[model samples]
Target: MLNMKSRYAMRALLYLAGRYGDGPVQIGEIADSQRIPRKFLTVILSELSREGIIGTKRGRAGGYWLEREPSAISYGDIVRITRGSLALVPCAARLAYEPCDNCVPESECHLRLVMLAVRDATADVLDRLTLADPLPGQVELQPERQAAPAQ
Candidate 1:
């Protein structure tokens, strides 16, 4: 599950995506519309801005907007940036792998194998989505959808 900050970030990013090319949006508007706490939103937006996922301006007309096109930003990108990894265990992480404490070696661990599989499947689903993708219930996938290759 995603942390509150990351969840807030996604909502804010989605808001920005919808308002793309409409110019910067005020932070308060995003917080109010998304029901994220105003102070917390400021921190989240600032982090996103620092990470270059969103751009900010300051002035009477200043606000925040996505640095890239909405379709260019995927759910995977957001997850990785905010949450670090899709893995339930640290060892199963692709980008931030580390051995789990008190665990058996990788080659001998059944749990690790299952977790790696779960992580890949999770990445497949999340990576397949972008802010521009139709909402979950809005689009239907054919049965022909492919499983990700083995890890």
Candidate 2:
């Protein structure tokens, strides 16, 4: 249940990653190519720049570029920046933890245990996915093969 802002941030980062080391890319071009509204991208880019995730240049060739190599930037980095928290529920959150209203003791709560497991799994997956990874289009979605019937 990723929010729209997080989705947009990822898209923008992916666009930059695909064009990394090519010099700065125009903000308008990024917006057009990614189908993100220019005004919104402006705000997101500004935030990213402030966070040191991206660098901006000024002048005729001025635009935006990644401050570090794409491989150095993980999905978790972007998610954390854009969404503020990776957990779906406040109780599951590590940085923004707030016990659920109904739960008296989060430490022993079965629901919290399940949610924490989910949060860890999700974080692990995202942390491993770097911006320098192959583009989505390059990934071949192989259909599942049918298994032979047991003898």
Candidate 3:
């Protein structure tokens, strides 16, 4: 399961994406708009800024904005930045890996292979889903109209 930090990061990024190209936005505004607690969001934003995922400004109008174009930023990027890895199991992780306690030899572990597949699929989906993509429920996917059945 995704951690609170990752969830908050996604919410903050979505809020920033909505205001992209509008210049820096205040932390108070993002917290309020996203319904995230201002105090917790402050820490998250600071970490994101440090990660180069976001840029910050100081003063009355100071706040935060994406350091890169929204289209270039992916959910995977934020999740990896906040949570460190996308893999459900350490042995299946790309960046961070540790042999599972039950597995004697990782090279021959069948479960590791399955976990890796799951990890890969998750990475693919998140990497392709950009911050610029419309927020959930903001757009609906509709099926094409079906043709009349032949007599």
Candidate 4:
């Protein structure tokens, strides 16, 4: 349920991860290769740069690059930075918690408890995964696996 902004952030991060140690990648190249809007990427990159997750170099050959190692940057970190909280329900949010606007007492709300569990479970998976990890079911770029998989 992550919004387009968050998805784009991850996509951009992945693009950089793929080119780690290769030098900064221009924002234009990122937008073109990732199919993200250049204007939107400018805003997104600025935000990410402010967050210390990315760094920018200014000049004709300058661009953006990851500030931290790919292994150190988790999906949860990106989501939290862009989305604020992983909780589907505001009352269950750990980083941006706000009580429900109702008479129901927080301690007695079953729904709140379930939502908290959901938030934790979601965080567990995302926090453990990073851009360096290969995605499940993604085919390797090897000649041996070019053919179709077994039925």
lDDT of each: 0.89, 0.89, 0.90, 0.92
Model 4 per-residue lDDT tens digits across residues 109-141: 999999999999999999999988888998746
Q: Rank the candidates by lDDT, best first.
A: 4, 3, 2, 1
- Off-target runs (Cα >4 Å) in candidate 4 are 140-151
Best by lDDT: 4
Error of 3 at 86 (Å): 0.5
lDDT of 1: 0.89
Tens digit of lDDT per residue, candidate 3, span 64-134?
99989999999999989989999988998898888788666987788889999999999999999998877
lDDT of 2: 0.89
lDDT tens digits, residue span 68-89, model 1: 9998888888888888888988
* Better lDDT candidate (1, 3): 3
Residue 72, candidate 3: Cα error in Å is 0.6
**Which ranges of candidate 2 are over 4 A from the true structure?**
102-104, 135-151
List the candidates' TM-scores in order: 0.86, 0.84, 0.85, 0.88
- The TM-score that candidate 2 achieves is 0.84
Relative to the true structure, candidate 4 has a C-alpha RMSD (angstroms) of: 5.4
> Which residue pairs clash within candidate 2?
none
Question: How many clashing residue pairs are found in candidate 2?
Answer: 0
Report lDDT (Cα) of residue 44, candidate 4: 88
Cα deviation at 53, candidate 4, in Å, is 1.0
